[model samples]
Target: MRVALLSDCYLPRLGGIEVQVHDLARSLRQAGHEAVVVTATQGPDEPIDDVPVERLAIPLPGGVPVNPLAPPKVRRLLLDGGFDVAHVHMGVVSPFAMDSMRVALGVGIPTVATWHCVLAHAAPLVDAAGYVERWADRGAELTAVSQVAAAPLRRMSGGAPVSVLPNGIDVARWSPGPRPEASTGSLRVVTAMRLALRKRPLDLVKVVARARELAPGADLRLEILGEGPQRRRLEAWSARHGAQEWLSLPGRVTREELHRRYLASDVYVAPAELEAFGIAALEARASGLPVVGPRRSGITEFVADGRDGLLVDDDEQFAQALARLATDADLRDRLGAYARSTPVRQDWGEVVAQTVQAYGRARA
Candidate 1:
């Protein structure tokens, strides 16, 4: 089947939902299904890609234009493009999202959607709440990344056919085989995310810094990955605090290198207060590392509390969890094993196949 995967973001930019959309599109194509992605991007579309791409323009805060939204032309293009299924990543459902839904209905094609990001933070309730409702009756099926995210998105969609299809980790590419183990006797903790206030990258740094204070000679190493709008502010803040020594800012990492870091690291910590789904945490777990995710938000749907990894509600508790995992090798090994089992049944082919089935049902 030919599928049109629509999104507000795509490759060249690094984001959880963006990664999942691109990966799913690639998997669909690999599975003998033709897939095209329509995304909002700055400047001209680049030529380095195996899949066909359509770029859209987005409005900015001031005179400067932002590439975070797809233009109306996206709907026209998708309509003209021959496709069997219209699978859209409604992470930040915008005017384009509504248009896409309308187009699918007009073209008499089955429409499916994935609830990726928490919409409440992205825009007003009118767009976040009612827009999905307008498209809910139109959608054949809607899926959320995690069950926790489903409630909010479902409520927004007026209780559409919402299912929880947790994102899976590419365990083979992210295993420790590619990267060399740390030769030294230090516990390394890595945090991967765009440095945004919602992600709270600085909070992770503070937690690690506090952990270092408690275990003065524990030899804790911190690796901070990814870049974002808050780069300058975060860098200066890191300098002010004692976190500068332990913290290594490597900017954005490629998928291959990211997996290597995951394999080489001793621990993966996600301090996101507003995480829609912790895909990075899954990758870390798949790499045989224990996770440190907060008990709140969508991550709680996975990162099993106490069994597979630590889930803390506060900084004090999170710091304690980090200290405990750092000191206990057996605990790390046991939890890592459990983490691997968490998504053992998930496969790209299986996910795409299920999606195809949903599209078929949507048509009926």
Candidate 2:
């Protein structure tokens, strides 16, 4: 089955969705299926790693690197050959999705779309009523990354069932490995996320600062991973909040380096007020580290409070949870030990099988 995977974000952009799309497409190809990626082009002669890429015409605000448009030739090819499946990622009623849908439906192609971003975060981009009507009209099988992602997506489905599929990690690539790096005397707690406002990287800063005051002797050091526009602001805040001495800002890590960092760190902390699903936290858990994150939204589906990890509500509770993990090595070890035991959505192999199955379904 020839399957086309479409996403707004891809490699070099650096985000959870982008990473997920790349991994999923790669897994699909490895499984012997033709999985091609259709993404918004960054610009002329953009270096897109090794993936096969086609450019779209979507405009970006301030010429930001987002290309969410579709070219006619790609559309003609998708329609002419009748792609078994058009698996779209995180597309709402946006122009890109609308254009893609025109080609999909014109060729009598069955489409499956995965909801990646949390609905609340996507409110500004999607037209709720128009989106639902369009989604229902488009006639596509819908799947969401988690139950948290499923809720808001339910509205768009009308009466269609939304499959709760998880975004998977390449277990072999993202597992706990090496002898692990020592955080010196500090019980290392790391937060790996883009420095975006919605990600609330500042929340990590605030929580780390508070933890320093509450649990000074714990020798806590927080590694803020990933890069974005807010790097300077986060660094400045770390200084002003007195977490500078121990807080390290290591911007952006590759897949290999990220997994290594996970192994090195004792705990993974995410202060995102809104998280579609905590992929970073999952990677951390896969690397045998307990996670500290919020209770509400998609994160709860993976993070079981007091079990694999601790889930809190606000900044105050986030600080408390980190402090608890920092002070109790035995408990952190216990949680980390069990953290890896939690089942994930797609173990590369399963992702392959399910994707092929979706292609079959699309054909039928």
Candidate 1, residues 1-364, lDDT tens digits: the string is 8888877667766678667877887777777888887766443465324777776755555323234334447556766787778877766544555566666766667888777766555545644456567666765577777776676666666766688766655556655443444433357889788878878887787788888777675778889888887678778878887567788889988878887787777778989866778887766766766788778767676567877778888997888777766676677667766765555434576667777777777777
What ranges in model 1 sit over 4 Å off? 42-48, 56-76, 120-129, 178-186, 337-344
Cα misplacement distance, residue 77 of candidate 2 (Å): 2.7
Q: How do all models score by TM-score? A: 0.85, 0.87
**Residue pairs with backbone atoms closer than 3 Å in model 1 (clashes):** none
Output the TM-score of candidate 2: 0.87
- Tens digit of lDDT per residue, candidate 2, span 72-136? 75577687655688887773323555556556766677887777767776654454546544655
Model 2 accuracy (lDDT, Cα): 0.72
Q: Worst lDDT window (10 residues) for model 2?
A: 62-71
What is the lDDT for 341 in model 1? 50
What local lDDT does model 2 show for residue 101?
59
How high is the lDDT of residue 243 in model 2? 69
Note the Cα lDDT for every prediction shown: 0.71, 0.72
